[model samples]
Target: MAAVRFADGDWAEDAEFAAYGAATPALRALDAETAHDVAVAALALGLGPRRRRRDGEALRVEALGTTFSNPIGLAAGFDKDARAFEALLRVGFGFVEIGSVTPKPQPGNPKPRAFRLREHGAVINRYGFNSQGHESARTRLARRRDAVAAEGDDATAEPRGVLGVNLGKNKLTPEDNAADDYVLGVENIGEFGDYIVVNISSPNTPGLRNLQGRKHLSGLLRKVLDARDKNPGTAKTPVLVKIAPDLTDAALRDIASVVKSEKVDGVIVSNTTIARPDAIKAHAHGDEAGGLSGKPLMEPSTKVLHDLYKLTGGKITLVGCGGIASGEDAYAKIRAGASLVQLYTAFAFEGPPLIPRIKRELEECLARDGFKSVQDAIGAAHRK
Candidate 1:
């Protein structure tokens, strides 16, 4: 087989493209948060690897009433405060999910909150939904909305790429009132986003995962969906709830039930895990007090995603995330029943050049499997 090359040359072998591949090592040497900020700034300046955007029917998938250029999306956390989503779109992601934004700005947990398990290609982050709050994020998103609105003569032109706002509760907010924060979030930012995500799965947030309980989840989704509907001028935004990868099958069943009953539009099958693998246990930062993301999470997260598809009988829209390191991984998620897939840890580790590579590999995977469209492959694993 010929050696696959991402850019004009094999980036792994080319010194000219080394800067992109080197971002991981350079980032690992700094405080993880600081390194993240630097990357975000670079993205804003469009200093990362660049590529021509690709669009066509083959790469398109319809879900949430939107046509995604590809099934791969830039997951939440990278653009946590709604900064740099536009730049990300230009990098060729089919969609970009920003924020785990709260009602007010939060400092999050103390420093050393994020760590890289380089040997394992994994990461741990206990950032506690640190955000610039609803108003700050909404302001930036509104500006984006306005800028796009003014871009051409067609004031009502279709959105170029899908945007999802991941909404979370403030750290100090009592679990009893968690629904209020999400309700306010949908009303305030829902209009600006093509979709909204109800995030209640981060291990970093105390008591937040409790919202995943049947009683709490049902109530929360009801209130949040109601808020999404109340937004004026804009159509009802597709609402999704992200769950932790550590959840039990019983709990997943409950979530599928609540999501169906409440009419939630989609589900991001799994978030980072609070668990660690025995294989990576000896690595430094292995026992860090945060959610673990990347390669080690692949099996568990995909299992959850697959089970969620079966539990929901493939009726629920699903977005598979966590441990996606290649196009094959993304394709696996699709076959497991994900209408879409997202990546963040892999993006941080692999850089912008990784995006096009994954897309190309995904298309190849579909063709090899004799699938005419990516959408046709969704849930094929569960056909038996």
Candidate 2:
């Protein structure tokens, strides 16, 4: 009896030790949206361990004609309001993107639109680009900029980590006038952003994906670029289009042609996906009517990134996103031709702690691969 008791005690200790060693539990606590808010608060308050000891090394990457202290950035949909800029930057991200903010504020889809599939390390969201509108986002960003500037620590302080504003048309906007709505967003919020992303790929928004058709996409890009030109002293806000991963080879080629002809700055290789594969077969919410992110998205999105890289011939910058949860994932995107990478679903599964972890892993990966810097790794896979 004593021997059995001792064995059980030993097993318990091992379990406890393993739990302490793993970083998954804390990351899985908050639900998708709530976890995002909590992370924003933590970053704003500087609550987490400043230096993630586990992160292997540091990497600096440049993209869209701007310099980033590191290659990891917060993808859009994390801070839709632009309210947590300071807090997110404080968390040590290389860049922070806010909004898919529309010209008018709207409550996204009905509740319970976000779901978690823990076993797959995935989330499905049909947020429909719910936003507080450009006016509100612009107002908050303007105030944040003033506060940062007032601190008077311009040199040593972070440049608020390259603010990128993602723009999308309002739900009610017709396809014919989508360009007008996009222009409204560009004209109103262009000055506050380091760059502007034209989002036409969100699966939740009604008929939004239709804008990706070549004719419509070309017109929208032209108008948005023209709007940027009209804004004087507003250093040409590099315009990039965010695309959907479900597009076929022909569709991708058409969009790539539009990007080149319009001279757009870059492409966020993908938004989330509506397709579910065998990998997520056992998940209950697999059929949910929204885009699936996290591990389920990695392969499909990376394939899209590779495709875009080839189609564009590496001319335009590519920001790979979807299902990236670690340094290895980010490294894959970078080597596949992404100039930079962003994350959202991984944060849902790994928590804020994952940021520095990924950065560290990426650095180690660079060293292991004999690349001196992140730029050296870009398209390494495709080059072969």
Candidate 3:
């Protein structure tokens, strides 16, 4: 773990890159899952070293009725339990998503389910919605909400950073009953989150992806939205659906239609894919039976994001995920049509230093293109 320094500062050029080479490999020496736990613990204790890059006005993005300090957010799987979101925010992410929490606690798939494709800068995991469940997460989230409210504006003024909960049903839940678990999550955790994500895309859970089908999707979203509207004094939280990159174009179009008709707030353009690209074939874990994330997923995922943008005519906000490793990758997503982009594998591989590096490069990319802000860069390629 990096030492905690009270003085806020950015990394020295030589020091940051040296830390990157040492960081991921050191974590990889331990088993994949154990390394993940250690990282999460470091964040919860506020010992995680972050390179704080002050966002230029060009980096701030307004979406979903809130201002994002930057368009880059930490993706869901990184902090699945919501225990360390405040610490993560302090790490300089515009937002940090936690959970995929189910209605009931689950142990998830058997151990050794997470693998590192080091040569390929990717990971394959069949974590199967491993969640601490809704109750535990709700309490944690509610506490953060109450504490932040108590702090009242005296809290750091960084665009009131966003906290999103990505909800998934328990592994034991049958397909037909999945909606029940999702609704249960929204009812229990919605009021505490800036937004809620209906995660029907993870390929690990049996029949979970089936829920993405139009029939299942519409019903599930309607019930979840109804739960939100019925929350007595709670503000209406935006709900988004996460999809897999493996879907066919027809399937993608169907999803876009459901999102539009259901009045969903946004789409998280992809989840990790189950497909193994040929480039990673030589890596021993290349054929691992799990959803894959990292460098190889960049193009396919961005293509889907771009397609979804055109399919929706840029009507819905899109949070692009999968294979984002640098500012250029992030910039590509924005130009492809992502209003916001997410980081997980990049955060894991490059460490916290990557956050500021991305923020700086992204703003530079926007300026180079003659755009005023990240928002102006959204869908730039499509507009061209």
- TM-score winner: 3
* Ranking according to lDDT, highest score first: 3, 1, 2
Q: Model 1, which residues run further than 4 Å from truth? A: 1-19, 22-25, 153-159, 233-235
lDDT of 2 at 241: 92
Which lDDT tens digits does candidate 2 get at residues 12-51? 4344324422644664576766655665665444343322
Q: Who is ahead in TM-score, 1 or 2? A: 1
lDDT of 1 by residue, 72-114 (tens): 8998999998888887886678899999999999988988798
lDDT of 1: 0.84
State how far residue 312 of model 2 sits from its true place (Å): 1.1
Candidate-wise lDDT, in order: 0.84, 0.81, 0.85
Which portions of model 3 show Cα errors greater than 4 Å? 1-3, 6-24, 50-53, 233-235
In model 1, the clashing pairs are: none
Candidate 1 vs candidate 3: which has greater TM-score? 3
Question: In candidate 3, what are the lDDT values of residues 214-321, reduced to their tens digit?
Answer: 879899988988887888533468888899999998999999999999999999978999887788777888887889999989999999999999999999999999
